[model samples]
Target: MDVTKKKVLNGYHVIFLVQNVMIGMSLLSLNNSLSAVGYSQWWFPILFGIIANITLIPMVWLSLQYKDDDLFDIHEKLLGKWIGKFLNTFLIIYAVVLFSAIIQHYLDLIQISVLPERKITGHLILFILLTVFIVKGGIKSLARFCILTFFLMGWIVYFLRWGIMYGEVSHLLPLFNFSSSEFWEAFRNGYNSMIGYEFLMFFFPYIIHPQKAFKHASIGIWITILFYLSVTIVGAMYFSEWQLENLFFPILKLFQAVDLTFVERIDTFGITIWVFLILTTAGAYLWMAKKGIDSVREKNSNYHIYAVAIFTYIIINLPFTQVMKETLYEKDFYVSYGLILWPTVLCIVHLVRWKKKEVV
Candidate 1:
């Protein structure tokens, strides 16, 4: 498919696309991720938002330089075909690993919290089928799904009010109490929640108003930041420092603060609805991996989507030990950090190439 000819997503699509992707699985465990900084973790989301916005500059700048090409195609254009394709292989691998890791994490959560009695095979098959169906519709379809999920899941944040009303205001005090090294560790660990925006590099070509993409994406990032801030602040207020550090999924506990007579287990409901966010996140990555394959093969085919899905299933099902699997999905975030910083490298290359052409 000619992605250049399919630039159908508008500013609104860009806004929700960035927001929904960044608000996925990580949010459930985010308080624990930032526990290195203690209760002051409430403000870390703003810092992350700033960092994300700053990094977005080079990504948007590089994307604007090649309005008709994605990061994969731009790689081939700026670097030589051989070197670009070599890098593209790694990009494809990153996308596939991320896609599988996301699904694996979500499935494990569901089995533990939502369906403890059921085996995960059925859930995995169903989730993959839904993800494939969504991705088959392409980026525009994915954008629409994102918009839908944003509205559907966004209201869940309001439920945090219950936690806020009951929480101790004192817990939010003692700001900046963490050591610099501890703050750095919190930044690194919590950054996983911010991973989804870098995906804009792959889908930049599909955005209808590429010129305004930076503005739209920044808006999306701030919106997510506000949502995260509310949760983190509420978590700080509601949970003791020890609880914040020990709880595997603090958001679930936050949901338990809602004492509605009509609903018995709001955390279960919250987690079940959370599948929508997971689908959008995983679907976007799956689409990105498919595009990477398209770039590698020099053709777009539905089979590439299925191929990626199959590969993801095989990877998730591999007989690795639990520790190894956890390391692959949870501990190994260097690749994501590298991708976020990669745009600066490309921008430097672009400037050098421009200078050489002008001199010639």
Candidate 2:
């Protein structure tokens, strides 16, 4: 495998990366998740998402403080060398676990929802082959793949339109308030689904053109939220707060309800978009993990290290039981919670440690 050096992503490419990272299982789970609180509060995640990203900005900006040095440099400098190394080690484990969980989730999703009778192992092989294909393409090719997924963007828009056409406004009236406890639980539960901001830790260094970094990143978040808000609205609109109560993947089912004269099976189209979304999510995390490994080397060298890092990730995706797959998600969520909080705190700690009176 020839590991070619790639340029940083452009402005539009950043939007692609951001949307892809946040869309995957979260979109699939949004209905079930919002349903956890009742559809009356599906918009809570929408609001919570905006708030969470507001808090996340400082952490992302902190990474830029060391824009020239990558995350490990930022970590070591603020916390001292040993602590930075320890954090780097933790990041590697975090990325691998996150990657594996997505693999497990995507495979389980395709097998259960669309290809019920197909052999489970077939999904696993597709996972590995696609992972290899995207990684081999490197970041540049990953951007192009994101561009290709734009073709499916039309389908997403159409799905939303069709669902809305059949949706009744009366289904959404009578805003009922849950107890304080339920509201908080719903908000937090929705927050759990809004992952992927901390990825800037690894990817910020690769945005290529630093001058436009913040501009591109902001556009990415806004677009992601817009796309997902439509998803939330579709779920809450088509299904009554009561109807969507316990259904998992209502977003998928919403599309399932669409019946075109010639395009009888909309499930196929849904699965296709899901697969495209999966690649972007997987590719982003893999790029982060791969970038971290490359940072340990001197710029660009043999592809062996990158190959082994990703190959190990591929092996980790193999699981025989559904329970095991869900457990991976549970574990990744807990671990990611730390990633979200730590980076923010690390930035403050760095600022105090440096004792800079003003921004350097």
Candidate 3:
């Protein structure tokens, strides 16, 4: 019963995946959302983001101890086979639904900004088809794609800061305008934008260098939080709260507002860079969904399942609409039900089972 892995993407690849996965299109709307919660104290979410990762360190360690078993397998070992299967099913659905919603939102932005009259369904199909083709290449190709995005992330951040030198500082005035509860509430809900961290459960087993995963994931979380905090601060300073709350892409809006002597349209440039970041994030989730299937007994399941799931996502989002997308964010905090609570409880039960077996 030796289960061999067909997915060959390694640890170096995981580093890139870590960077790419967190830099989602939502990075643009963070400030606007924070503002909606009536808080200019933007550091609160950044602090919570750091703390959340620290809290998950035990889960990370327990995951590594299993010789690279993904969360699904770990669940199966502790919970019964049926219960594990049910959880995995929910995870698959969760990823597909959540990412589909994301794709639709981005497509909504492009349609409104780039082509006001273009149909989203066709564009969504074409875009998701592109995503599927890439995933079909399997883990190695996906990992390499992620590596490319890491460089993109670094350069884009540098360009954004350097390119927009003329941004207004007054926009950031009266930073302490909101109450403590309002700030913390916004921070707690905003954690969903940092949603990709949960994928480590599926990806840890595939990591070519398992030993570095905890360290790398830790560093990755810190870097992502810093980037997010910086982006929020920049957006906060560049755009008024009302403008941000209504704008689909606040980061791009900030760029659009800037007028340096040499550059007339930093916003267009920002959108272009965003395409790469968004594609990488979407692709990483598709890959993780595929990898989650690797946890099953059938060794080759991930390779095929990933492709199928991508096509399925295409169907779900192809006819997607722009209405009430914020409703998804409503459930953002609710993800704790699955991502944190369920996994944490299962991990403890797993340890108890392991200890009892050792005694026997």
Go through the candidates in order and give the C-alpha RMSD of each one to the true structure: 1.1, 3.2, 3.7
Across 1-360, the per-residue lDDT of candidate 3 in tens digits comes to 113544465656765676667667757777766765543645645675676577557667777777657777876777879888787767765666566656766777777677788776776767676777667676566667777776765665554563246556665556677677876666665665676666667666667677777777767777777777777767665666677668756777656655578877777667655766677777766765665555544355544454655565555544445344455534633663358546567768877888999999
**Model with the higher lDDT, candidate 2 or 3:** 2
Q: What lDDT is reached at residue 272 by model 2?
A: 58
Q: Compared to the true structure, candidate 1 yields what TM-score?
A: 0.98
Best-to-worst ranking by lDDT = 1, 2, 3
lDDT of 1 at 112: 92
Segments of candidate 3 deviating more than 4 angstroms: 1-3, 6-11, 36-39, 158-177, 260-264, 293-333
Give the residue spans of candidate 2 off by over 4 A: 1-7, 174-176, 296-321, 356-360
lDDT preference between candidates 1 and 2, better one: 1
Write the candidate numbers in order of decreasing TM-score: 1, 2, 3
- Number of the top TM-score candidate: 1
> Which whole-number lDDT from 0 to 100 does residue 314 have in model 3?
53
